[model samples]
Target: MATILMITGDFVEDYENMVPFQALMAMGHQVDAVCPGKSAGENIATAIHDFEGDQTYTEKRGHNFTLNANFDSVEAEDYDALYIPGGRSPEYLRLNTQVIGLIQNFFAAGKPIASICHGVQLLTAAGVIEGKKVSAYPACQPEVEAAGAEFVHIEMDQAITDSNLVTAPAWPAHPAMLSQFVKLFK
Candidate 1:
């Protein structure tokens, strides 16, 4: 089983962010959840489920997938793959130097990297998606491309594997993306 590290930040899409967990584990890959750390060794995991951005919508209370590990404590060598579930989480993590560096390490190792929706933001911030073709929520396209990524609009159903990177738009493409990620680990 691959030691996969998955990260989530606040305003995360609860369902979409966590859905791939089931798929990954069922396929025999070991998935570990990660998020923003506050104090030393303290991390708070948020959900993307029912999270509404400032644009105005409804938001539901999210799941608390809390863990006790500082981002600095994370070692890229420990994971065989990485996943950044989309939501408002990426926006927050994109600004975190530690998280960005972790992402860089993962890519530097040529590990499988999977992201969905706004999740690409983290990769963009890490400068890992530069000149790479990617797809995300429509609103994220311009920014991703500006960050040196080639954005494409496609269903999130199947995992769009680009090099060691895999992306999807959103829930509509979740199934496929999850399956493709599982296969990557296999």
Candidate 2:
């Protein structure tokens, strides 16, 4: 069983955060969810990003997700893999130095990393996606490309894995994304 660290923040996507956490747990993996500056038992607001035929996905208030671990207490080397969910969180999380360093540590140590939707923003900010092939929410195509990664286009249910990085466009690709990610443990 892999020890997975799931990083999230306020306004993280509801499904993106919960689905994988529960799914992996059901599969016998230990998934520890943490938010920067938050401790165990603290909750963060989740957002629902639904495609209501608007120009983009619509957002609404979602459930409160509780953190089961303390961010300050975790070290990247202690985990076997990393999971980053998408939502508005990445917009600001990308600017967090500690978050960026943690991400860099994972990349440096070659641990598997799974990122969805806007979560790719952090990978861009961390400078780890350079020269890698990845897939991200369509809106982040330019940013991924700008960061020196080749953005892959695929069906919503598909995912792309490049070495230790597993990426999906959005929550719709969770099944494939997590499946590909779990394979890294072998």
Candidate 3:
């Protein structure tokens, strides 16, 4: 079983963060969820993003997720894969130097990475998606292109895999995304 590292922070999408963590564990993979500046046992708030016939998604309070790993102790090489969930958190997480470095290390090691929705923001900030086809929320197309990567406008329920990266437009693509991501370990 692969040991995966999930990087997330406050306001991470509710489904995007919780579903993958639980599902991966149910599949016999070990997933350690962590957040920058937080230690193990700490908790982070989540937000639910729903597209309810509006021009943009609507947000609501979500469950509090607990961190199982310490960010300061995480080493990219210690895990086989990296998972990044999306939400408003990515907008700020991209500003963390350590977070960017951790992402870069994963890319340098050719480790598999599964990122969804706004999660691509971190990848773009890390400069690891250049020349790669990545899928993210529709609003992130500009960021993807600006980072020298081709932005793939995929369906909300679909996912795209390029090299070691598997990405989806949103939580609705969880099945497709996880299926493709797990294959990377094989």
**Which residue pairs overlap in candidate 3's backbone?**
none
Report how far off residue 39 is in candidate 2 (Å). Answer: 0.5
- At residue 176, candidate 2 shows an lDDT of 95
User: Could you give candidate 3's per-residue lDDT for residues 8-108 as a string of tens digits?
Assistant: 99999999999999999999999999999999999999999999999999999999999999999999989999999999999999999999999999999
- Candidate 1: where is the Cα deviation over 4 Å? 38-58, 68-70, 156-158
- Looking at model 1, residue 134 earns an lDDT score of 90
State the displacement of the C-alpha of residue 19, model 3, in Å, after optimal TM-score superposition.
Answer: 0.0
Worst 10 residues of 3 by lDDT: 147-156
lDDT by residue (1-186, candidate 2, tens digit) is: 999999899999999999999999999999999989899999999999998889999999999998999999999989999999999999999989999999999999999999999999999999999999999889999999999999999887889999999999889998899889999985
Tens-digit lDDT track of model 1 for 97-181:
8888889999998888888888888888898888788988778987898898888877545557887888988766777777676
Error (Å) of candidate 2 at residue 111 is: 0.7
Please list the Cα RMSD from the true structure of every candidate, rounded to 1 decimal place. 3.3, 0.7, 0.6
Q: Which candidate model has the greater TM-score, 1 or 3?
A: 3
**Candidate number with the higher lDDT (1 or 2):** 2
